[model samples]
Target chain A: AQSVTQPDIHITVSEGASLELRCNYSYGATPYLFWYVQSPGQGLQLLLKYFSGDTLVQGIKGFEAEFKRSQSSFNLRKPSVHWSDAAEYFCAVGGANAGGTSYGKLTFGQGTILTVHP
Target chain B: DTAVSQTPKYLVTQMGNDKSIKCEQNLGHDTMYWYKQDSKKFLKIMFSYNNKELIINETVPNRFSPKSPDKAHLNLHINSLELGDSAVYFCASSHPQVRGGYTFGSGTRLTVV
Candidate 1:
């Protein structure tokens, strides 16, 4: 079975400072990785996803994540933090063997709450 | 218009009561899913339906049942609700062809008293 681990439960960063959230997954084969963001009382919004190709994948809202296969990590990063960017973030992994028929059921990590301070 | 919508944004009921949460998607996607977000903010998939057919059913309690009337709608019904069942439930839809990420609803917060 696949699983995801997010090391940080909560993180605080000042505006304009760089931020990185760590995520690691345990899966057998090449996994489909995704990063999602959720505001308070709102559903999750996709930040980015990695199926294959480039190691560094850019996403919405000036966020990006790098897939490091050797380390089993897909950490989300931003060059500078904004107050509006503060939210709960989750990293997920899905099996590739699920194929088109299964539509890729995901195993999500315990979210990391980001707090951006002025 | 909302791409994905879940009715009763908040539901508060006594334990042992039964309740249902309805979800509908307007994106014309063939796949719909139900996810539970616990107090710790951990999201876990509960069930999935494709074209009104059950696809993935997680190891959730039997009290939690999902019914899909069609490809566009999936409803969750919980019986003998417990305090542990109190959490935010999310509905999502996706297009299988593009491998596009899911579009999620605002979520329904169910509180058991």
Candidate 2:
């Protein structure tokens, strides 16, 4: 079974400070990792995803995540934090099945609440 | 235009009453899914349909049912709603073969009073 674990339940960072949200996963094979953001009273937006190849992947809103296969981790990072960047973040893992039928069946973590201080 | 849209962004109904939430995706994706976000902000997949066929069904109650009239539409109907049913339901779509990111709708907040 595939699962995702986001250790940090909540993280507070000052404006212009660097931010990093930790994420770890357990999968049978090459895992498909994704990071999503949800603003207040809004649906989730895809921040970034890592399928294969490069470990460091860039996403929208100046967000980036690095996939470490040895560590079984895909942590999201940002050079500077902004007040508008405050939102809930989720880390999800998907199986790399042969027929691609396991695409939408993602196992998400409990989510981490990001608070950006002004 | 919205790539994925869900009707009734806010729904309030009394317990024991039945209601339905409709979803539509115009991104030409072959698979659509329904996910429930509890009050604690924990998200879990409830069901998924591929090409109007049931592909993934989680350990959800039978009171919850899903219907896909076509490849572009997937609706969820709840029977005898209860207080525990109050949560945010999100509709999302993605193309599996393409291995791209999934697009999500604004979500429907169902308040079971």
Candidate 3:
């Protein structure tokens, strides 16, 4: 079973400050990692995804994530935080072996609430 | 046009009542999924259909049923709703070629009073 763990429950950062959200996963094989953002009264939106190749993957809104296999982690980072970036972030993991199909469903973490202070 | 759209953005109903949430995707993706987000903001996969065929069915209650008339549509029907069922339900679509990235709908908030 593939599971994602987002240790940070809530993070408060001032605007223009660096931000990082830690995400750890437990998977036997190479896992498919993803970071999703959910704004107020909105559905989850894909921030970035790591399938294979290039350990570092860049996503929309100046967001990027690094996949470290040894650490079993994929942490999202941004050089400078913006007020619009304040939202709930979720880390999800999935794999071909998850549901006996390549399109295996994702298992998301509890989510980390990000608060940006201006 | 929205890639994925679910009808009845907000649904408020009494307990023991049955309701259904309709979803349609214009992206023409072969696979569609239903996810539930609880009050604690935990997102969980409930059901998934590939080209109108049942592929992945999680350990959800039997009362919750999913119907996919076609590859572009997947509707969720809940029977005898309970307080625990009050949450936002999201519909998503994706292709097998695309690994783990799913395009989600705006979500339908279901409230059971």
Across the candidates, what are chain A's individual TM-scores?
Answer: 0.95, 0.95, 0.95
Where does candidate 2 stray beyond 4 Å? A98-103
Better of 1 and 2 by lDDT: 2
Per-model TM against the reference: 0.95, 0.97, 0.97
TM-score of chain B of 3: 0.97
DockQ, per model, reads 0.60, 0.67, 0.66
lDDT of 2 by residue, A1-118 (tens): 8899999999999999999999999988788899999999999999999999999999999999999999999999999999999999999988657664465688899999999999
- B2-106 in candidate 3: lDDT tens per residue? 889999999999999999999999987999999999999889999999999998899999999999999999999999999999999999998864485899999
Sum up the clashes in candidate 2. Answer: 0
lDDT of 2 by residue, B1-113 (tens): 99999999999999999999999999999999999999999999999898999988999999999999998999999999999999999999988642586789999999999
Candidate 3 DockQ score?
0.66
Clashing pairs in 2: none
RMSD of each: 1.5, 1.2, 1.4
- Candidate 1 structure quality by residue, lDDT tens digits, A10-116: 99999999999999999877788899999988889999999889999999999999999999999999999999999999998875564434465788999999999
Residue B24 shift from truth in candidate 1, angstroms: 0.4
lDDT of 3 by residue, A1-118 (tens): 7789999999999999999999999987788899999999998999999999999999999999999999999999999999999999999888777355676678899999999999
Report lDDT (Cα) of residue B3, candidate 1: 95
